[model samples]
Target: MANQLGIYGEQQAAQYFLSRGGIILGRNVRYNCGEIDLIVQMGGEVVFVEVKTRSSWDFGAAESVTPRKFTRMKRAAAAWLEGQPYRSVRFDVWVYVVDKGAVEHYEGIDGGAS
Candidate 1:
């Protein structure tokens, strides 16, 4: 059930991004070590986004991405970029609070500068 909710949240995030003029490059893009939840093109940058969603903030908010997860995401982003057509890239995080139906888009949350 939680997994389902998370997937639904990712879908919502993808849609929100699209509505905000983000072009969808890929979804659930996977390499050997990890998977990127969403790949989008915004402005001139290829954006790799990780989506986190939660029904409540009892434990913590959805922004809680661990170091291990970031490492995996970085590896996945590297794998993705090695075969991509873009020269510039950025990593982003989209946190969706399900109970509030709100989406917070955090650009350049990882992988250095925007």
Candidate 2:
């Protein structure tokens, strides 16, 4: 049930991105380092999205994105980028509170200047 909700959250996040003019390139992309929830393209830039979902906000959904997870996401994104055409890239976090079916999107979560 939890896994199903997570998948449903991912689907919601995908629609959210798409509604804002993003083109989803992949979903649940796995690499040696980790898995990326969604890979998207908006305008001319590539976006690596991380989706965090929770049944309730008792504990914030985005709060679960630890530093370790961020590092792994970066590594996975780097690995996924290898051999691909050069393009500007971004990292985004999509938080879904499933109980409310609300999505809060954080764009360019990686503050490091690209």
Candidate 3:
């Protein structure tokens, strides 16, 4: 049930971005380091989005990410970029509130400043 809700939030996050003139590049993009929930292209930057969904907002989005997780995201992004041309990238976080069925997007939360 938890996994299903996570996937549902991912789908919601993807659609949310797509509705706002973003192009979906990848979903559940995985590498040895970790997984990126969604990859999107908006304007000139490649955006890596991390989705965190909850049945309730007892713990907020900002409270959920740990330093270790951020490190993994950076490592995974590096792996994903291997062999590809240099592209501007940034990290985004999506907080999905299941009860409301809405997503709160945080653009460029941390890292990937190029």
lDDT order of candidates, best first? 2, 3, 1
Candidate lDDT values, in order: 0.80, 0.85, 0.81
lDDT of 3 at 96: 90
Worst 10 residues of 2 by lDDT: 105-114
- Highest-scoring model, TM-score: 2
Clashing pairs in 2: none
Mark the regions of model 1 whose C-alpha exceeds 4 Å error after superposition.
61-63, 111-114
Q: What is the lDDT of residue 102 in candidate 3?
A: 63
The count of backbone overlaps in candidate 2 is 0
Write candidate 1's Cα lDDT for 1-114 as tens digits: 999988998899889889989999899988888889999998899988888888865545433676667788889988888866798888888878787877677777754222
The TM-scores of all predictions, comma-separated, are 0.87, 0.91, 0.88
Show where candidate 3 strays beyond 4 Å. Answer: 111-114
lDDT of 2 by residue, 1-114 (tens): 989988988999999989999899899999878889999999889999999888887866676777788888899998989999947999888889977877788888763211
